[model samples]
Target: MSNELSVDNLVTGYGKQEIVHDISVSARPGQITCIFGPNGSGKSTVVKAIAGLLPAWSGRITLGNTELTGLPVHAMVRNGIVMMPQGGGVFPRFTVMENLRMGGYALDNKQVVEDRIEALIADYPNLQRRRNTAAGSLSGGEQMMVAIARALVTDPEFVMLDEPSAGLSPALVHETMERVVSLKERGVGVIMVEQNIREALPVADSVYIFAGGKRKFAGTQKDIRDDNHLMSIYMGGD
Candidate 1:
């Protein structure tokens, strides 16, 4: 009943190599928890491990009182945990409507799916305008919106996103960050791995900065801004 997603001492990696060391983090409802680092810092690795896309070599992942350690990806979704990977996680060939439908595949009721889709279209006017358009045809920002909206079709309690602002314009990056903040307002636990430090810092409630596959700092926005050492790490200084 805690309504928080917690990862404890997580260690995961590709075959015969550990990319993520023993790292612990938590995502609380109604707040944004950001994980940020330079390339190869294992930020995405941790996200994948929590999403059940990668197996943890050790440690535990929990949501409320439920243990999510070994659950498959589908079971994680059923348990109200959704992961929207990087690069706009939609089927490129499918229409926006079809992609939305696929997002609610876990639901058994057709009316529920329709209702959710309708609600999403109302929330995102762009989606309504492009409902029949192929997902691949949309711009980067629009596709990002579809990926996020699709994740919400299941109404997940905990949502994870990887580098949503990777290749977006300044305006679109601002817009995307705003949408992420809105997710927290809706009482969803948001765990975001972002490279856009400027955009991510303002909206984040807490932050974890990783370097060399290990957590270098974990604190609030103010803490990050005030610490010169942390800033140095971000600037690629040894």
Candidate 2:
């Protein structure tokens, strides 16, 4: 079985209207694959489709040979494909530990859940300090950290993050991107949809650029950096 997560000829949309037009992308273990486009370019739609929140009109999503196209969200979690949706979607009323526990909801073994949560907290000292605090009470960056920690509880092989750097100060954006890089360092394949081209490019191992619901570019960071026209269009225009 291949370790890479591959999306081939993906075509998906809302209600009969196609937003993403035959887009294909892939991510390998321990690498960061970033999808970037302007607003209304169908970046998030691709993520939602891969995460099983939306149905694929056509195409295939696979982890190695395992087809992930129609799997339910919980089933995807079980397959080590966890998605942290846009804006760090955390249950505001829930305590930090409670939120982490929710990430392990798909796991059948209670001991495994507890062990993973404990290990995550150990790795994130901030989570240890705020374990009992309500998620909403935490700062924005802190909440992002909580969201990441919760996702990690599943011990996912590949994580899909939508707009991870959204709604943050420049400094916090850098910190958040660092956390994302750390995920790659831990051998987790990361598929990130981001708007901050400046920040996203630095960490991106590979990039896919979309416009009008269609992919316009796909290559390494250097490929993007070398293309003066693309840099002007996405970086200057975005």
TM-score of 1: 0.93
Top-scoring candidate (TM-score): 2
TM-score of candidate 2 relative to the true fold: 0.95
TM-scores, one per candidate: 0.93, 0.95
* Candidate 1 residue 150 C-alpha distance from true site, Å: 0.1
Model 2: residues with Cα > 4 Å off, grouped in runs: 225-227, 231-238
lDDT measured at residue 227 in model 2 versus the true structure, 0 to 100? 53
lDDT of 1: 0.88
Point to the candidate with the largest lDDT: 2
The sequence of per-residue lDDT tens digits that candidate 2 reaches over residues 17-55 is: 989999998999899999988888889999898889998
lDDT by residue (tens digit), candidate 1, 1-238: 1488999999999999999989999889888999988999999999898888999999999998999998888889988988988866789999999999998888888799999999988988999999999999998888988998999988899889999888789998998998898888888889999998888889999999888888877888888555476678665454
